[model samples]
Target: MAKDMLNAVKDRLWQWLSSDPGFILNHCERILFMNEYREIERQSSALEKMQLLLKIIIEKGDDSCQSFVDILRIHQAHYWQLQQFFKPNTQGSSSPTVVADGGSVVTAREMENIRAKSINMKIETVSGAGGSQCGNSTGQNPQADYIATGGSVICADKICNTSTDGDFNLSVTVKASTQVCPGLVDETLPSSQEPAVKMIRQHKEKLVDCLRSDCSFILQRAQVKELVTDRQYQNLKDISQSEQTVIDLIDRLMSNGQKSCTLFIEVLKEPEVLRTYPQLKDISWC
Candidate 1:
């Protein structure tokens, strides 16, 4: 039962990464070697890229996962979901968020065990006995670790707890009917959980895709709304690179806490600003 729940949490984590694969990848850069990162980046498939990323997190074990989460700065609401899986009274207390370094991060084995489940997580649709396995190349066993376990009492499909008596095996299968965690799509976060920051974080890739033409206006609004200090605004306004400027902007906003993020959301809502970034429209303050 515990393993299943753990895997469910892991599955949720992977699916959450899907929310902003590029952003997650960017944070991952902080932990990866240039060569290792290049290898994952070359995959060309976001799913596979995510797979490789999770694999590395697993290989890096507990500490690296902690670092990755800190580097990502996961939001409190999402962190609450993880709390469900890491109940304090349970033996799994150290499962993901361990008490260390004044903060918490996930365990790498969580990534490892969950990846093998192949719960699909909306990646592919497979029905019943028919499922696609990850491909291989050049006499290599790339799919070796992801093959679905046969004959084990454990069933990875529904993510339920089942005790089995047999040697352990591993595999992955992709299918449509696979049940993903509802938390990914449902669950209302508490009002204080910085929804604005979550929104900005989720869209950070788009905001930083280029030096947005609205960069100056955003700074103007930030200054007007008192969201950024004059010094901070001038520093960001001076940066020529759109990417770093936007990244810094987000970092600063999130650092300032919920009120700043709320004002930042307002900046994105201006008629002219929304004209440049339509997706950011209809947003309410966090």
Candidate 2:
């Protein structure tokens, strides 16, 4: 049974391993013993090194296939991206999950899901009032080593925390839902109900003047984020004054047909842009 499993696994994995020799050899060097790796490294070509790496893992037996997988995941090997072909996670009871010997094992895939869920949450600032998930406010900030004024709030794995440094300390309690609890929302805060682009175009005149000094700054950022193209960036740069730069940017966005003006509006709210243009804080939508 084991021999058949080994041959099947080897034949299936070989094509993926052999597809990129340098990639396989690079990862193998980290997994294989240094002395043994040096001999493999001395092999004339990447194909030879990969072949030998597979041979070494095969000789070590079935458990080593899982070890090989664990290491590939460790180095973030490219094979994992071909999930359609490499479905290790769906192996059921045949493949074992390895737990590292030491402290907690950190995986990027888990962290990515956590961050993805948190990004859509909008943490609007209010009067520094108490926001406890349990609905009990002591009317005083909690005794803590540090405090946060405000920035972003993250809700993950039933815990919510503010990445803040200014306002009174808040302690949000547990809930399995991926949203910021409705209690934290301040209903009275000024916000627009209209689509962001429509709201932006409605206030274009005011925004242009407000954004004058920051045109070059906003342009560089907008281009970097791909909201504006290379040609637009260069053309805007050649224009003499900050006011014209702002004007041309709006005109291009209006003509581009992507309704990308909202993206420009979003760029104004970015943390880096806010440092230069804090007035943008006034632009918010529901």
Q: Tell me the alpha-carbon RMSD of every candidate.
A: 15.6, 23.6
Alpha-carbon lDDT, every model: 0.51, 0.51
For each candidate in turn, the TM-score is 0.31, 0.31
* Candidate 2, pairs of clashing residues: 148-164, 148-165, 148-166, 148-167, 149-165, 149-166, 149-167
Residue-wise C-alpha lDDT for candidate 1, range 224-257, written one tens digit per residue: 8877667667767887876666777776565444
Show model 2 residue runs off by greater than 4 Å: 1-194
Q: What TM-score does candidate 2 get on C-alpha atoms?
A: 0.31
Model 2: lDDT of residue 229? 59
Candidate 1, run of 10 with poorest lDDT:
98-107
Residue-by-residue lDDT tens digits, candidate 2, 3-104: 345466665455555544444554453346644644564554445656677788777776666666666556443553233223344333432332211111
Error of 1 at 15 (Å): 32
